[model samples]
Target: MQRLLPQHVRAATFDRRRWRGLDPEQVYAYLDRLADELERLTRDLCTANTEGERIRQALRQWQSRHTDCRHTQVAPNSRWHR
Candidate 1:
């Protein structure tokens, strides 16, 4: 099945010029549900992006500290000193 995008949801139209056309109320309700789903998805995406950035920053800080320890020859446990 093809997935519907936000634009597609917004642009949906039902035939109303015929006696057998779809009910307008039902169509509008479905559109409302689609909008709600789109909003929820957007929020989830933003939360995921924020968490990913946080992890990247933590990794960078750890790498910097590790590099500093390697270059300084004076790590806290100094196995060479023992």
Candidate 2:
């Protein structure tokens, strides 16, 4: 099943009952609040994903640049250590 999104909440409709129906204004207000919150959370999630990707890329680059150095070992009797 597809997950409900902010747009879905905003576009939701309900049938009205002539005898005992819910107040349309109240329903709309609640939907608006829910949609706004969903929108904010979605935005935050996107930003977090972008930042995570950036960090991962940086880490990969750093590892690539340092992999060789990390594998190199220093000798105790090297010329520079004399």
Residue range 1-82, candidate 2, lDDT tens digits? 9887999999999898888989999999999999999999999999999999999999999999999987887798997655
Candidate-wise lDDT, in order: 0.83, 0.94
Cα distance off (Å), candidate 1, residue 9 = 3.0
TM-score of each: 0.64, 0.85
Error of 1 at 25 (Å): 0.8
Q: Pick the candidate with the highest TM-score.
A: 2
Please report, as a residue range, the 10-residue window in candidate 2 with the lowest summed lDDT.
73-82
Colliding pairs, model 2: none
| TM-score of candidate 2 relative to the true fold | 0.85
TM-score of 1: 0.64
lDDT of predicted model 2: 0.94
Worst 10 residues of 1 by lDDT: 73-82
